[model samples]
Target: MSSAMDIPKGRASYKKKDGILTLTDDRTFLIWSPMPANGPPTVSLALDKILNLKQTPDTSPKVILKIIEKPKNPDEQEGQSFMFQFTSPTDARTEANALRDLLSQLLAEIRGGDPNVPKPLGAAGGPSAAGGPPPNAKPPSNRWYDDDSLKADTQLQQSLLDKDLELAKTHAQALALKSDSISDESFNKQFWSSRVGLLRAHAFEQHQKKGSYNVLSTVKPRAENGEFKLSLSPEQIQSILHQHPLVRRIYNENVPKLSEPEFWSRFFLSKLAKQLRGERITDVDNSDPLFDRYLGADNSLGVASKITAAQHVPHIIDLEGNEENQGGFKSGNRKDAEMRPRANIPIIKTLNSLSEKIMADVAPADLEPSGTPESGAKSFDDARVFNQLSLQDLHGEREAGSIRLNVKDQTKFFSNHGDGISGEDAQIYAQQNPEDVLFEVVADLDTFDDDGAGGIDLRKSIGVDDDSESDHYEDATMSGIQKTPHVGSRAARRAAEQQILEGLRKARAEHAGGPTGANAVEASPMGIPPDLTERCYLTQMTTTEFLKQFWSAFLSSSSSGDSSEGGSAAAAAAAAAGELAYHVESLKRCVERIEAIAAEAERDRLRAAEARKKQIQEHYQKTGKKLKWVPPKGGRDSVMALFEHTTAAIEKAVALYRGSRG
Candidate 1:
């Protein structure tokens, strides 16, 4: 495998000789095409599954795949990736390379399966691969439909086992964390302003180290009905604002401005954060030394990091968080006896050196507990490799080009973990910047005239059902992206240019029409690199595109933050985004409640209309009964109720929103 492609163009192009689609990363995907009537993807075949997996073991390699059976049959399949963090750019590259190597090896193992023979495991009670029933199994359904919510939810939910629910819950927790940094924080104005320089530096490190850490938190409003408390301090406010995707976009806008070290390094303790949280940028094998340094495992796409904290740090977090034995990683914070631990030294040094002057600062009192108990690194630690799963696995939205994940519940995980930024701002930031992102791939290729004019069905060795109306049995597979010509042909080149210009024009027109999200695509002088420009995106481009865009914005944010990583810049705002999200979610609930009432009103209106029509018809049907004018009734109260319900909810939510704005 060359540069192992994590997400290849979710499309396939085949060469006649091989009859297989060869990707740049050497991942040759074989479509069983005309998916056998019984093989619908996503199944495990263990000894116990013999009775369940009716398809006799095939000679072809068992492609260990996870097929997301979407609500629609046309949705494509998606894969998962694990991620890890690094302190430096080099480490990021190294981590990515390591994952690449693992993936290659894993794929190779998958391809080693026997192709012609079918192994028969003993048990027998499943459907056959050829659309027949096993010993005594029920027939497969040929149609899908939805008549009612309860009926639909019940049947569909049956397909999801307890195991699936467990997986879903795990993902939900990650989403919660991705939204908010932490819940509670007095993160007042004085401290927030004072930390700006330091915070900017941290932002740089955060992006450079971890492209994007899907974090979440939940914040309870001080008031029962409002979205936010009226008394949130400026620090808290700033924190929430920073997390806004729009605000973050602004913060990182025109990142070329931060290529200078002097401007970013203005803070006295800027380098301190760099040292404590990372390794030197140099010594990385494949990535730029400076930018590649301080990588947080999953973000680095094979960049090497000179740091080896993982080699020395020893921890023992159990499958479930417990104190029995620490998990298995060693380095840095878990110091291999080389670095000093500040446990006994006290944090006064850090507190005093917070600002530019390093003047006197009050030390936190040890008398009464601040009740802000801090957990050691070992508390939430997991295997670094296990952490390599893509941000979706860590957060949600299991594909590229998907809508950025929203921060619905913020107070689940990131609450008062680091610098305190207000909860309200955290909620706001999350709403503005969505984690569910989108993207479109373009492949660099050449086009040529079809050698033969009559090539309607130049079919492959792959199965093609002649009886079926659809040429491709599966509508949702990675077969949708059509091939395009390369740069050589004049006509092809002209067409590509025209398309590009058209897209730009449309984008500009849209921008003029309305406000786009802060991170919305923009025109830039330094366009995508011409050498590695994409020809077109994969069929499953949405989710992949989202990942790419989010990462780009994230990287830009990192580049824009100042050298000091301890301040209020992005950190505070990120916190605030979390808080604001809570407000939005609450507002959404209010909307839902109003919508429910409106629905009831609509039903009642229909019922009343039916009754009135029946009475009118009855009067006409009678011998002497006659009706002249029929008065409109009940509509006033029902409509009024709907309005009142909606307005009241909006009012509460808007007030909460305004509170966060201040």
Candidate 2:
């Protein structure tokens, strides 16, 4: 009645012990190795050790008990944790749910009615009490604010500034009429230099904000092939006119003669009007504060002034002239007709002082945005603790070598051969040799060891097959003569080394002399043996004839017997060595030819690809149409084609060498 579910072999390290689990009303969980007549349980854990439990029920059912282990003693290090897993019998889902409910009740009783303990695992599929998250759980913090919201606010602020500038122009015109101490000439001069200049500067600023300016027009190039045009909305055109009074004045004077679009288009395209459209004014500080004072929405400005301006200001739009009205000004001389309205100075001076006072009383605009949480906090430690799992400490401790398998008492299984060499000497030897010692050892051990019988079996002690005939010359050149494994004792190893040294010395002496069969064949002018004369004479024989000559030479070389002299074995070995040398030379020439072909193919592929890319770019420039890119054949394809041919040649070469040896 007190037993819990069974623990599987994979989930728990029962380690030669029975995986039986038990739970009692006293809140103790026991894992017994095996039941004895009168002994304590092998492992016992209190209910407090468990932090949470998770259950998974499917074709295979499991229960995961997350343990928050307490230190057995005060001297123990930090981060001891355990997660025990148990499996259920048939009717897994029902059994798991019943166990979960019982555990939840037990947890509640242990906590003495505290509701903050985690709910039992299987509750995920069931309906919960009519509430959201627990009150004790912390809410998500706003230290990392949304970047998109900040960007949107910045754009909105810039748009609001543009609207304010438009409203100020109408206010300036209204103030010109109401103030008696100011003349129109003085007011117009200052307004044109400061307010109108800043408007042009602001437009250029907006254009720069887009990262680049297209010289032809503001319309950006699109991916598709199509003609496009940029146009202004009615609201944008109105704002433009309010900001530039002269453009409005010229358009009004000509409105009776031209349509609105035609008049504005002509004005914008005209050379003289282009000169007045914008100025490269970097220092807005030198200009008057007329724009800021007349239309700023800051609270420091007088409420009465804002209210009066809002109620009484007439928007400064150009008055379109009729035939009778046009005649009055149209009849004038050229100089008189060109005369423009001037700004009043006293009204402008009064506005500057008022703007200065208002700005001084109000808070300055914040130039810098709020910083990241780490940077904004007075101390880094003041930042909130976000790690709620209480398990990250376990990972760090485990990596630091805690909970390692104790193998100190086990006997050594392998001897260290390199231990005899000092560390510095080993390092120096390794640095001098580019090839790794481990590969050298493996290659040495790969050769035929001495069999107890007299005949050489040529079988490896390590069970590796003999090296392929194609690799014989290359392996000899790169790795030197491979050593036979020295079995038995130190005396046996030394005797084997001495025997190998003697054989190498004798072979070198014989090789330095001509090969044993050299006297039997006459050499051609190209230094080819007479046995291979027909194959080597490219001008005299066709490829088919050369192949026939090669096959005959291969058969003769293989069938020929050794001389019956006292040095017959050495002479036979020498003839075999000569044949091997000839095969190696042929392989070298084949490799060179293959490399040349591969290189030429790669260069041609690159040139073709470059030409194709250039054609695409030119087409795009001529038609403004972007085409989907089609790649040329890569160099890998060309190289692989050459590789296939090279591989066949190598295989044939190896077969010929093997046939000759046979």
Candidate 3:
């Protein structure tokens, strides 16, 4: 039995050739007569190409194998078939049956069926001689729907159509559609108008099915009535626990003793919460007695020790261990300020914990587990380290010489005869009079005043006015009373000092009845009343808070859409739509608040202005002297200015939502 097979030529014809049959490792059947030359087998056929196998019912049982022949050209109408017969009265039938089973199994596998079970012989789905059902036929459908279920399905589709119609009507109204007639053109116009909302709604529905990472910053507590309220999703809860193991520990310990809601309420107000949130903790900050006890649970030093224990620093790069020998001195253990334990130990611990969590989450799966002996050994391989430490030979290296200039004519290369100017003209320009340059420098220097003592007088150099110069001179003369030699003429200095003293006395007498100088209250910028300013600030903050919530929902609903088909996807879409609507309403209310605040501030300003004017007139009539009145600066204009950007932002959001619906 030969194991090797020869590559057969196109459609070989056999005429009762005596040969030994054998199957090769690659599933090729071989048949060849042993020749004196000892060449390759003459007949070879692949298992995959065999279409059918059967045995002839004769005294000498012959196995007939039908196989498809490869076409020489792709455009050939049909492939040819070849039949091979193997005779052996005793075992031909058994071999034919086995071969048929193998071919059937291979066919099943090619059609993506169970290869272990051989398929039945004959064409699939062909009618039997009795015209009965095909072999292995599936049972008839047992599923049946009642009228009520059918009605429900019909109603659902009708309701969806009604919703589309309602959306169309809403969009038409927004577009200011004047016609009531439902013509084809009008219907198309309405549909196109409503298409944007339909797309947005579809997108919103799709987004709800996707999984999103929890944003810790968005999980904030709001003050409702006198107590703080917080809402946390299951994912957010898991995220918090994963980020802060201390919080997880506290919750595990205290949950059975305290109700969940009460525990969360206390946690939000605790010093531990403030530390976790990275807020500065002061003595006056609100604290929970029970929760505050766990404030010191996260030790920075302990975390550092854990981190150090989990790291495997190779001896070759161990900075801490080799610090003593770094500078040829016995250096004591020292760390940089950032590397040292921080004053806020809990905060530092939280930071380290978060960093470790992030690294673990993002690290590749292929990396070996940290702090393991095997991992360390693989990480710092001796051969790799040796290769890295080996230095390249520099002694045998040749230094590159400077580039050589191959100028055909050195005289031409040195000449400045190209472009605009000739060599003679350039020389003449360079050699021009040095006196003119000196004259220009002298003219520029003349702007500065040379004080006989090597330094220029800065006041004169900077062009100080006459009044400022006299004031500076007066100050210098006043200082001259202490025997300063900078000021000239003692008599002149004394006269200036006496004049200044007289002017000061007159100013003090004129403003004796009222507060003056530093004591006088400065008017508010833009004449805006303090109360109105505070109200504006509050309104702005409220608007900002609303905007944050609005965008969060908006973004969450605007992300990737769900392509899944089910009741779950439909439910998710409905929930997302409701959330988006709630946030949009919030933004609209914030805009309204802004307008109301602005109007109220305006009314108050008008009333205050009238009262102030009445008082001023009465005082003027009684004293016969017009008192200087600085009217309150900012009124409605200032209030509006404060909220202009926020109002515009809200308006833009409202318009966007409106446009989307339209």
Q: Please provide TM-scores, in order, for all candidate models, with all chains considered together.
A: 0.15, 0.17, 0.27
lDDT tens digits, residues 258-342, model 1? 5322212221123322322222323333342333233322221212111111121223312223322354323224646656564
Off by over 4 Å in 1: 1-572, 627-662
lDDT winner between 1 and 3, please give it: 3
> What's the candidate order when arranged by decreasing lDDT?
3, 2, 1
> By lDDT, who's the top model here?
3
Ranked candidates (TM-score, high to low): 3, 2, 1
**Residue ranges of candidate 3 with Cα displaced over 4 Å:** 1-311, 315-317, 320-369, 372-375, 378-525, 561-564, 628-630
> What does candidate 2's lDDT look like per residue over 1-662, in tens digits?
32364422221323333343445333435333222302223344555444455555455545554445545576865335644454335443554455555666665565532333455554444443655544334344322143333233434334535577543434343333323443554333323322334444444455452211212123122333553333645545543443334444454455547765665454444432322322222333233332222222222222122212112111121122342356543454435554675344333433443343333323222111121221242222222222332457575534465686867654464456778899999889878755577778767755657676754454455343334333333345467775554343344545789999997764443233223455532332222223333222321222222233234445555565444346776687676566455444545454554455446555756786889889989999999998788655424343444245444656686576765557
Better TM-score candidate (1, 2): 2
Candidate 3 per-residue lDDT, tens place, 1-662, comes to: 21242322121224554444444433434343222213234444545344444444546534565656445367864456656565554665565555555555555443332222355565255866678766445334321223223223333333444666644343333223222333434333323332334444443443353322323556778988986779876557655655566776777577658976787777877788777776668999786788788776752321222223333444565555575466422234544546565567655546655665544433221222333233445354434545557676734677888898887878877565555787899798789789998998889787789887987886666554545335544566677755434333445556789999987764443233123343322223234455555555555655665566566656666562355357777777776677567657767766676677668767877887888888889999999878777665455665566566788898888787676567
Error of 3 at 307 (Å): 8.6
lDDT of each: 0.33, 0.43, 0.54
